[model samples]
Target: MYPQRDVRVRHARDLAFSLLTPEDAFELLAFEIAERAWFEQHIEARREQFYTPHGMSQHIIECLALNAQGRMSPLLIRHKGVIIGRANLHDIDQNSARVGYRLAENACGQGIAHKALNHLMKEARCIYGLDTLTATVSVDNKASQRVLEKAKFTVVDKLPTYSQVVDQRLGCVVYQCALREKVECP
Candidate 1:
């Protein structure tokens, strides 16, 4: 099981990262609504229900359940107490996890993603006992690629057709970060 306490990391005077809880449903829904178009530009289209409060609440519940199973850690990006984005360490295994993140349109180009990711990497290694992390970014998403690079993840592969995002099959770059000399999975 995961720790009950929230994971918090402060990057600057205004930007912070915190573990998202079920109570954050409304705020997260608001952020998702506001940034829907912006996020869709980079990733796959979200289900229509995901924009609703009920759907968001259900999603939060699922995230919490995953955390309980030691399979995921979903976090919110907050700027001056306002929810602005989300980051997740998902598909967790014994010694590794996959990372994904998204920022509000207004929060872009402010170094928030890079800082948040760097902090999450530390927490994943030290607190969660994960020894390696991986992330996949669309080739066209230079911003996200840069964020992964800034967090010291090395490019490991390139897929000409990685996955479908909306109607297109997007090419992607796979990145990995090794956190420790050895990983022991219980």
Candidate 2:
């Protein structure tokens, strides 16, 4: 059972990122289609900074397979059974967890990212046994920075000229969230 099974944050507010099941593959396929055009037009060029659509979709499938094998616990954010986005707890250490997410371009400006972050934070604390959450974001993505801030992540440091995906010495902002506080699971 999920550790946060008994704890549902009201702020989830119609947004949810429950565990992804094998049956959700078709759902994910649908989401891929829905977000394809936007991703191609807006996010594709920055393939080095972010995963390509094909790569992301394959990663999703792999995560699902891992989950089924009891190797990971990944969640997919959806509305009314239609997948919209995803936030995952990967690269987990004894005390920290690496988190990442992507939303369909049309899903931006909605509370989806915020809610997903909140949900992951809660799960990290209650289920994943984590103390801190870390996120590495490309320097140019103001929108991601905003989402991290809204989720109460603080800018911890800036690493200069890192990552091959970024062609020109783009700095990376490291953000973190502490789960020791009384966080409301969203």
Candidate 3:
């Protein structure tokens, strides 16, 4: 399990992931607003309330609560001190967790996500004692698939209409990373 405190991980010169907190609500809101259109095309549709600062503050509070319970690790992805997007390890179960990430439109194709995910995987093993990490990507999101593949995740399953994005149901491809033998766990 993670320690009873926030963790900030820096993967490269300008890329890092910091544990989310209530104080980050405004920056999160700004990131959401900037990436809303780009992200809506891939992930499930977010509620209108999620676009507001008040709603995001509540969301951050809930995430922190989950973090306290060792059920989730909500992190804000930053590039040179600006919140670029989010990277989360949620649905944490014994020795396993689900990972997901979103980057600003301008940050795409820069190998940032790959480095960030690699760092997260290391943290998952060392901090959370997680041996397995899973991620689900929309079938149409080939870029994300590439990122996962580059991070050593293998395609393990496919789901028909796994989630609803906007008005359409999108198929998903599930990827799994087995790190039990790759990392030393406490």
Candidate 4:
């Protein structure tokens, strides 16, 4: 059986992040529908850069299921109850979990992504028993890379053609950090 991971409704700074229940499929669908054009035109490229639509949505379903089972936890980032973005621990393993996220185009440059990531990194270390975390960013995504860097994810290596979408090969940089050695929890 999986453990009872934390269900945080609000952050220390009083920001709102919500847990997505399977029953909340409509909400998720609504979010997807509202953000479709934004996601397709902007985020879709990154989704393809990172994963397939089937892959991303399937993984989200699996993550939501695991959240119910207590094996995994994912938080949807919202501001004043408006769905703006998402961040979660994926590739959850015995020792560590990988993380990824996407924000609405309008949600960019406001430090919300950084705040969400900081929250999850704390969960991974203090609650999930993870010692390390990993993430990948497209070489051109300086904003995301900055967010990760702000959260202390260090550049570990340059992976060539690490991501492919629609027959296009894009290079990526992998970043990592030990959850215990750095990042003080709030």
- Superposed by TM-score, candidate 2 places the C-alpha of residue 120 at a distance from the truth, in angstroms, of 0.4
lDDT of each: 0.81, 0.69, 0.83, 0.71
Q: How many clashes (backbone N, Cα, C below 3 Å) per candidate?
A: 0, 0, 0, 0
Q: Which candidate is the best by TM-score?
A: 3
Off by over 4 Å in 1: 1-12, 181-186
Residue runs of model 2 more than 4 Å from their true location after superposition: 1-13, 40-61, 65-71, 163-169, 182-186
lDDT of 1: 0.81
* Candidate 3 or 1, higher TM-score: 3
TM-score for each candidate, following the candidate numbering: 0.87, 0.72, 0.89, 0.76
Compared with the true structure, model 4 gives a TM-score of 0.76
Candidate number achieving the greatest lDDT relative to the actual structure: 3
Over all chains combined, what TM-score does candidate 1 have?
0.87
TM-score ranking from best candidate downward: 3, 1, 4, 2
**Per the 3 Å backbone cut-off, how many clashing residue pairs does candidate 3 have?**
0
Across residues 27-128, which tens digit of lDDT does each residue of candidate 1 receive? 677777767777888898889998787899889999999999989989888877887778899999889999998887766777788877877787788778
Q: Write the per-residue lDDT of candidate 3 for residues 4-76, one digit (tens) a residue.
A: 2122334446776899977887777877876788789878868999888788888998999999999999988
| Native-to-model Cα distance after best TM-score fit, residue 170 in candidate 2, in Å | 4.0
After best superposition, candidate 3 residue 100: deviation in angstroms?
Answer: 0.3
Q: After superposition, how far is residue 133 of candidate 1 from its true place, in Å?
A: 0.4
